[model samples]
Target: MSKFKYLIDGIVKNNPTFVLVLGMCPTLATTTSAVNGMGMGLATMAVLLCSNMVISLLAPVIPNKVRIPCYIVVIAAFVTVVQLVMQAYTPGLYETLGIFIPLIVVNCIVLGRAEAFANKHSVLESALDGLGIGIGFTLALTCIGLVREVLGNLSAFENKFSSSDGMLVFVLAPGAFLVLGYLMVLFNKLKDRKKKA
Candidate 1:
């Protein structure tokens, strides 16, 4: 496949969130608001990009037996950097994201890309793949967050539209699953329609 295909595929065809259904913890937990969702997505993207490139570069020398451990170390390193930076700069978002931030080290999307794509692809290709997947994940979280916020809070990005709550359920755990299920169906339908066309 071409380099650009790596990028586009993640955003639409092989989206981590909507398509692959990876990273559900952060997706469901942090997306109570658009800003929180976007923040978590961007943080994951940063880790993915860096880890993919590093893993791709180190693939040749990494022993097969130790590869998984090495990958974790690399991912953990980047995650620590992200955690510290977020803690220092965006303390509120940092707090909101909380444990989910560090958990990116174990995120399936990140690790799966490292093992499945990064280890085999060139550095550039791996980076692009990471970026594509990251963008896709970001968009999915943002959309879910937007929907939940608008419906539950009667607001967008925490901006209040009215004094009264819209649908309290949407702001809670159950609402994440509800919104995700509907969005997943909607996305799949679109994909199927495009394929038929």
Candidate 2:
């Protein structure tokens, strides 16, 4: 049950993107398409997993004063690896993702988990935390991307399913914000209703 708490934290209570709303830059910018969303999510997931593992292993050795720096170094190392590997193998995605990929080093989601959860937890716990948070982030991004693509660009939903112009708001950058904001409001309302019932 304790392990599952990580899931709750990442998905509902402490989401890196929507709930806590960290990493807004990429959340707003890279979510123009489903492809870009997946690319960013996968890249971020890799960095989170590796950093969490490293932090868990070094939890004992990482000093209290220099803990932040140590966690960052570990996270940055994984981000660099993800950047290089993506550049070599998925040049198209790398190009599309652009500077956001490099920005993973500073992304609060990855570093936040490292410091708040991973460093204080056992290796298994840290790994689970990383996975949960990573998945939550990916899910949120994908939803945002889908809405943006379908509403901002008519081709987004139609291209995947049938052949018709759906709407253009889903593709534009402004549409992402609009959709996300509404979604957040809806989620909050739903949560409140559940609490009262």
lDDT of 2: 0.81
lDDT of 1 by residue, 78-169 (tens): 99999999999999999988999999988999999999999999999999999999999999999999999999999988889899969989
lDDT, candidate 1, at 172: 96
Model 2 residue runs over 4 Å out of place are 156-170
Worst 10 residues of 1 by lDDT: 156-165
For every model in order, what is the number of clashing pairs? Answer: 0, 10
The best candidate in terms of TM-score: 1
lDDT of 1: 0.94
Candidate 1 Cα misplacement greater than 4 A, ranges: none
lDDT of candidate 2 over 65-160, digit per residue (tens):
999988888888888899999999999989988999989988888888887888888988888888878888888887778777766564452366
In model 1, the Cα lDDT at residue 70 comes to 98
